[model samples]
Target: MADPLDLFLAAPPGLEPWLAEELRELGYAPQTTAGGVTVSGTWSDVWRLNLECRGATRVLARIAEFRAFHLAQLDKRARKVAWGDVLRADRPVKIEATCRKSKIYHAGAASERIARAIQEELGAPVSDDAALTLKVRIDDNNVQVSVDTSGEALYKRGHKEWVGKAPLRETMAALLLRAAGFNGKMPVVDPMCGSGTFVLEAAGMAGGWQPGRDRAFAFEHLANFDAGAVSDLRRLDGGTSLHFRGSDRDAGAIRGATANAERADLTQATQFDMAPVSDFAPPEGPPGLVMCNPPYGARIGNRKPLFALYGALGETLKTRFAGWRVGIVTSDGGLAKATGLSLTESAPIAHGSLRVKLYTAQL
Candidate 1:
């Protein structure tokens, strides 16, 4: 058996606890930290996390660590580490460095030393646009090396193409759905759905599908990659009976969401319609989760008219969507309060450049 390794899962700034909870539920002991969660496991666990995790934005495999006081010592220590075990000779690599409160605080010198070490020791060429990325951090003179096993990101689930204005990321949408007490047993409705991210993710979870099934990861370029073992980890989930639904005022957004759902093979489970929030109505079934990522003033148009829009949404849900739960994501708390629903604000989450919160309530 391979020796255990320290793996770090990076989440959005304020979403570490949620990511930690998600990892713990996946049968891993997660240690929550300032920016991310650290879990220990073998190589297969690293691959599995990259393949299965929906809440994580990126997975970094901690390879080695040592204390170095100066640039020469940092180079000496970096040369002793095993680089060939993680990197391939044919595939190029990119190195990023960070430093804080350390004697060897120069990020450029640290990065160059490590890059030279990799070239001389492992014969792997270094390039800016490489497939693999190695991150070096020298905090308090402690040199730590990590390889980014996730290439692009977990949110680029390799299916979405037509994105509406300021589309909600897949990772945040999944985390929001989880926070709203959704377990995929009941139905899901997004009235102001931009590109149907929440609806599609709900369907994927219900069908036991892997989010990274369609994407290529940086782990495939590692030395220990096993084709047969990875094949076992790939799961193409079957169709689900529980229908997930979404609607948008923009007909183009509705068409794009439908195309994306079709590409993800979730057309049967997810349906998108071109309708405004005033015409929103519950599907013919038991009450379920009513969630939407509505427009905030940050990216879209003016916020003056949004009060009426929010009031209309709240009134529609209040009169028609009885006994159903609601979650609205917006950066402005006042607009969320304008809904007039008794909602509990989830902890602020890092969305693009602003911090956004999810306002949820049971009606």
Candidate 2:
């Protein structure tokens, strides 16, 4: 067994507490810190986090940390750190560097030096297209090198090829679901579900499915990757009896969401329909939660008509979804309030270029 690596799981700003809570539930004692959660674990823990964690944007494993006043010092210190234990000697790798408040402030120079050291010491080919990356950070003359264990971010999930305008990312949806207190025991409905991210994510959790089960990770290319061992971490609990439902006004969105659900193998537990907010009908069972990432007018459309849309959505939820909770994600607070729902506000979070927040209320 290799020594425990310093694993930093990056979550969207304002969501570190929830991510830490999730890690505690997953049996890891994580120290919640600004920007990410820090946990010490081995290669298997890295693999499992990349596989099961739905809220983490990137799972970074710190391989080396040392002080280097200059590039030559940096190169010497970098070469002394163990690389063969975690990285493959024959595999291609990429280097990314960031420098702040350090004597060796040239990020590019630091990356080049480290890359050269890795190639000369470990005989690894470095390239831009490599699946493995060594993230170098220099701050206050202290250098830290970590690897992005999760490639293409955790939200890609490999099943959602089709997307709608201002589509909700899978990671944000999962965090929102967790924020909304969804335990996967009851039903979930999304009236304005773009590509069915919230619905599908909720359904997968309800079914005890691994978020990364169908995806490929950058850690698979590392030297310590154990395919047989990681395979055992997958959830074999089968599907859940609870249902998840999504409705979109656009017919194309409905079709795309259904196909995406099928691709995720979640068709048995989810439903998608081409229906507007006015047509929302609670499922046969008990009321669960109504969550939606509506059109946030950041990249797509105007905000005028969306006021009516929000109002209609609020009216429908208020009249139809009694005893059910509601969650909405949007950048404009005015639009969220336009729904006429008494929602509790969360701190602003970064989504794309716009700042958004999750509004929660009981309907």
Candidate 3:
């Protein structure tokens, strides 16, 4: 049998449980951490994770891990790894190293040593624009080396070509939908809907679209990966269609959302409108989900006016969206409280440098 896959999925801080649950739904047992999750699978499974997983920032395949006391031992172990089996000599590769509380504390030297070994011993061409990236981390006297399987961050999705200021990432949007218990059978509305990220993600989920279908991953450059299998998997049918709706007061945001939805082939699945939150109307459904990433005061121009915006949002939700589930992503807890809804649960999630929280409520 093929060697078991040692996969590590890095997430924004405080999102480990969300990533873990997502992986479990994909038929893997993931061990959660403060920064990420660790799991085991095959090469095909790794492809699936890169293509299907929406909550992960990057998917890494652990190649080697050992205890190293000094630079000589680190170099010897790094050189002995079966790089030929995993990496193609025809493709250029780059190594990034990090050291913490280790005898060999110089990360740059370690990276240079590994690069030299790959170039001199394995005859591999090293390039700055290498498609494949190897990451080395020395923590607690243990050296861990991993290969990045996803070329670009999974959040890119290749569909959203336009974005508003402080737009939410596609992966974080998808996770927020999942956290809100959105199964795509009901309508979803985003009142603030900047660049329509949340709404588009909902539409994709409702339409049974795979996030990575149109993207390229780093594993395609590996020597042992089967290109045919990857192509076949992408061709697999995703069977589901559900209603999705989005409205924003900004006309520019609406136009961007329209174009982005078209790029994702989701125009048929999503409906976008130019309307302010006060004029927003809930879609025709029993009890669906309403998710929004409103402008936080830090990025936007004013803070005092935003409080009124949040209050208006709360009023609208209470008056219009009875029985609907609500999820709001925000960095300001006080502003979140302006909604005046009884929060069912709230969990912290990292948004770049800011630690934002997803506040959810059921009307």
Task: Order the candidates by TM-score, highest first.
Answer: 1, 2, 3
Tens digits of per-residue lDDT for model 3, 189-215: 898887889888887777768899878
Which TM-score value belongs to model 2?
0.97
The RMSD of every model to the true structure, in order and in angstroms, is 1.3, 1.4, 1.6
Candidate with better TM-score, 1 vs 3: 1
Per residue, candidate 2 scores C-alpha lDDT tens digits across 1-363 of 247789999988888888898898899999988877999898889989998988899899988888999999998888887789889998999999999999998888999999999999999999989988989999999988999999889998989988988787888788888888788788999998779999999998888788888888999889888989988886634599999999998999999999999889999999998888998889998989999888757755688888889999999999989999998988889899999999998988878778789999987
Per-candidate count of clashing residue pairs (backbone under 3 Å) = 0, 0, 0
- Model 1 misses residue 247 by how many Å? 0.6
State TM-scores per candidate.
Answer: 0.98, 0.97, 0.96
User: Poorest 10 consecutive residues of model 1 by lDDT?
Assistant: 1-10
- Identify the runs in model 3 with alpha carbons over 4 angstroms from their true place: 236-239
Sorted on lDDT, highest at the top, how do the candidates line up?
Answer: 1, 2, 3
Clashing pairs in 3: none
Q: In lDDT terms, how accurate is model 1? A: 0.89
What is the C-alpha lDDT profile of model 1 across 253-315, one tens digit per residue?
A: 999999999889899899999888999899998999998888889877699999999999999
